[model samples]
Target: MLKIEDLHVAVDGAEILKGLTLEVPAGEVHAIMGPNGSGKSTLSHTIAGRDAYEVLSGGVTLDGDNLLALDPNERAAKGLFLSFQHPIEIPGVQTMNFIRTAMNAQRKARSEEEISAADFLKSIRAKAKLVGLNDAKIKRPFNVGFSGGEKKRMEMLQLVMFEPRFAIMDETDSGLDIDALKMVGDVVNELRDPSRGFLVITHYQRLLDYIKPDAVHVLADGRIVKSGGPELAAELERSGYDQFIEAA
Candidate 1:
């Protein structure tokens, strides 16, 4: 449901992503793996329309609509969600309120009715449980005092609640244990519809074991070096990224 064509990007006048391209169609999962500084995160940020990461050239589209032309908020409103590698800690903002506002924002943008408070709680409570989080965790300030794995769990909570048409998860498995990683897989599999797509950017193949991506891409030095099936992820784990790094 997302396409990137010969994408080029920069931030504050420095080049980052150079001629990168990939596609994640509906009902499929794609994993992007690479060493540090290969523009994995930049690709996600640029696709999400994050500020400062200017698209110097090329195009990104969500189901044929120009994604690069939209603002970050607009992209989000279009059912595009990016789960950051590091979730911020908003000490005073209740997690419940934050998610409710975001969900309502998307709904209002689409001319859908705002969820009733009772409905919001009911919906998110079910989603929260799906992500292995309890009601108390959802009641806390967003990510405040949460451990790394907990923050990742919180991100999954949002993913489940939002149920976006397309999601770009950046380093979502960074700190997750096997249980949390499986939670990620469960939520993804549960949301796997013919209208939903996912791009999972990660550094290791362990997460792939849980999600079973439809395709695997090796990104290095700002471009994709190899594209293969699930077997490629396993190959990389056995062979290492050293070859791709050199090729990049």
Candidate 2:
């Protein structure tokens, strides 16, 4: 389980996540819907151990392990993954090499043997196709010259390749079209399992049409003010965030 109890995080001198508390159990996908500046991204960043998103007080745990105590890479080694809201481009890095190195590093940290080159190539090729990336695209440097939708696909490619225990997808649907959205959903659904969990953050309910979260939470002013089943997303889409904004 991924648990956050009264997490308080500040970016710069201003607090963004104000006493936010949330829990995502294993084997379920939870969607967080909120307005702009509601701290949705902050919660994801803080959980992923991003720098400058200072945790003033509170606790975060992944299956009883204290997450706040671990460094970002250490957290990744612990089966935590965050798909960035805006994936960046690394000009000098080879996409395939970077991902393989990361996977091997995680395996090494867990006292497991490194994956063979043959196995990695096979897996990456399969996952790449699933995410709609061609061989030439994967052969390119990470995200360099790729379109916005392609970058999101690259993120999905990483998500599937890593197959982390917990995944926090921060606004992955932001720039994706219908086909891309379905592709994202396909990758996630393929990776979904009893031991894995997902926290999907988004502003629109359209993405839910594909991923179909197990539960939906309303995040306002850095706190989860309300929660419900998948229907909650539809409600937010119909009534909009005005009510939740006032309640927050």
Candidate 3:
């Protein structure tokens, strides 16, 4: 299980996540929904160990391992992955090259054998197909010239290829069409199992239609305002965030 203990995060002396606490057990999916500026992204970034996502207080752990003690790469090596809503564009890095490097780096850290080029190609090709990505698209520079939906698909591709222990997808369906949303759901459900967990953060309930979360959390003003079953998402969809916003 991933235990977040009253995590307080600040960036450049500005507090963002305030005493946020949550738990994501293995084999379950948790969705966090909230309005703009509700500190949702900060929680994801802090958990992923991004630079300058300074830890003001509290702790985060996976199983018994303290996650706040690791660097970003260290966290990745320990099986924590974050899917950005707006994936960055790297002009010079090819998609395959980056994934291979990441895979090898993780293996090297754990003293495991490196994956062969042929095997790497096979694995990526299969995962790309799973994410509805074509060979040519995967050959392009990372996120370069890709649409918003395609960038999200690329994120799913990585999620499937790595099959990390925990994944935080931040607003992954922001610009996805209905078809893309279904594809997102397909990718997530395919990765579901007893050893992995997901923290899905989004502003809309449409994405939840594809990936039915076991629990839904409403985060507002840097704290969880309310939490309930999947029906909570439907309620939010019908009534909107107005009531929750006021409560928060």
What's the TM-score of each model vs. the native? 0.97, 0.98, 0.97
State how far residue 152 of model 2 sits from its true place (Å).
Answer: 0.5
TM-score winner: 2
Task: State the lDDT of candidate 3 residue by residue for 1-248, as single tens digits.
Answer: 89998989998999988899999999999999998999999999999988888898999999879999988898998899999988989999999999899989988887889999999999999889988999999899998999888998999998988789999999999999998899999888988999999999999999999999999999988889899999999998899888877887
Kindly report which residue stretches of model 2 are placed more than 4 angstroms away from their true locations once superposed.
Answer: none
The predictions' CA RMSDs to the true structure, in order, are 1.0, 0.7, 1.0
Candidate 2 or 1, higher lDDT: 2
lDDT of 2: 0.94
lDDT of 1 by residue, 62-179 (tens): 9999998888888999999999998899999999999999899999988999989999889889888888788999999898999999899899888888889999999999988899
Highest-scoring model, lDDT: 2
Model 1 CA deviation exceeding 4 Å by range: none
- Cα lDDT, model 3, residue 27: 96
Candidate lDDT values, in order: 0.91, 0.94, 0.92
TM-score computed on alpha carbons, candidate 2: 0.98
Residue 35 CA error for candidate 3 (Å)? 0.5
Q: After aligning candidate 1 to the native by TM-score, how far in Å is the CA of 173 from where it should be?
A: 0.3
